[model samples]
Target: MSQENLELLGQSIAPGESRTVDFSMAKLYTTTKVEIPIIIERALEPGPTVLLTAGIHGDEINGVEIVRQLIARKMNKPKAGTVISIPILNIFGFLNAERAFPDGRDLNRSFPGTKTGSLASRVAYHFTKEILPKADYCMDFHTGGASRFNAAQVRIVAGDKQLLELAKVFQAPFTVYSGNIRKSFRSTCEKLGVPILLYEGGKSLESHKQIVKTGVDGVCRVLDSLGMLQDQFVKPPLTESGVLIEKSRWVRAQRSGLLHVKIKCNKLVQKGEFLATITDPYGTMRFKVLAPNDGYIINVNHAPIVHQGDAIFHISTQAGSI
Candidate 1:
């Protein structure tokens, strides 16, 4: 049997070879080309193709660091199959240190984009047409939104036995059956029969050392599980047993005030436990926040000042034993 060359972005990467491809999305105001950078590593043996994408939200730096370290450490030197990694998907957002595109559109919500549509739509359309069809599996890395912190976790579609197994192998501390959003990357992948795991950790824009380490280790583990890596990498130490969560709810602030958090993300809490306190400037008013159910905190807003009805804490309930 003969091995085949991997073709992507109008380039061919032969077996045992790796190449970086710069896919131009559009030109900037200064006419500089805006390209989505990707690294393709093709092994000598035949196997499945896996894709790793990050920076869809632009400010998610943990995933960016994870992909950087993965490439730097030569983790892409697989024993079989191919690894396609895109460290930054929204280059414009990343350059501006923002989460959305310059047109104020969320790239994550612009999947299956059209060529003549908005900037985000065009970029998404290009990736959907050119990159996604080559993948057997996918992993989209993310973090909590601006001013929010998320504990390292994997979000998968519910009732997917295959994806659940892969998520467990990834070994993130928490797993949420978070379902899918309309026109999202995951949704497009799902429609194309590509099973993808959405891994979230830390906060946006800032790289957390632990979160980055966890993401890197998780990617390696997934590769090893897929029989892609020749040398099996050592598994990172698990700080907490993996939990499968059935549902989660975000607790919102009732009144606008300065937030005084009494607990941090990933902390298990009992029902009625004091979670935080909202206070006015000058200490004139205070309101206590409490947990509504027994569960662990998966996400929290870190911003000191928040408006009424702002999400404060996300708690995972109905955790099923894995």
Candidate 2:
């Protein structure tokens, strides 16, 4: 059915009407069960249907926290339409704080999934079939997984002008324009004509104050844009504008040993600037890593030890306010 039909089915969603429902009637453990937790907030009027999702990669706790905060603050109240949240998708991986589910599948890669496929594929299929079709827009939150650290940034598919507008309104510290690869949540949503924003922040399984604050502020800004809530709650500074990054690259270690990174994430650097260096056990040999171009640090390797060719930093450069 078209989105217009869905909106027609329900109108003027009000207090006490907002409810949480387990879309998956059975737990993942059950042979015939699929578990998808959803929070539905129905406002008192007709408006756009927005979806906020996280934990596609079970280990990405920051996204989960973002969704939790959005829901807990009652950010969906008095909305013109519906704001749905699926805070956790990969239950098994989340339980263990691992990046992928138990079957060793990347949920994000298994979009538009099949029922008879692997665990991750099954979850992805369920999401596309059950959730994506209902929403007008989407925001999928993420963070660097276990091995790396990422600065807070919003990644919008390059060709999505409408989504880009919504993303800028989010007023995140960094907005990176990335071309979507096939099978990603962003790509799938795009194919369905559902504009989606991908928010990346901090590192996996760790908490950063700025990331959390920005996340809360980002969602509120979007809600304000969507007319879900009043404008007074929005953070004006973040809403002022954001830097736009066209392309990004990772600087890898040339030698294996201990690493000393001089620049933290979110710092601006010039081309050929010293980013980090690798030193041997006795410091007899040192490999200096330099920036290939002028850009800002979006992801930094937090691990002290590394091997040759391991990505140490991700930098992006683009003209205009970020």
Task: Identify the leading candidate in terms of lDDT.
Answer: 1
Query: What TM-score, over all chains together, does every model reach?
Result: 0.97, 0.90
- Separately for all candidates shown, the number of backbone clashes (residues 3 or more apart, or on different chains) is 0, 8
After best superposition, candidate 2 residue 250: deviation in angstroms? 1.5
Off by over 4 Å in 1: 237-240
With a 3 Å backbone cut-off (N, CA, C), the pairs that clash in candidate 1 are: none
List candidate 2 stretches off by more than 4 Å.
1-16, 25-34, 230-240
In terms of lDDT, the poorest run of 10 residues in model 1 is: 232-241
lDDT of 1 by residue, 205-259 (tens): 7999998888888888888888886675564555556888889998999989999
Instruction: Compute the lDDT of residue 124 as modeled in candidate 1.
Output: 93
* lDDT, residue 220, model 1: 83
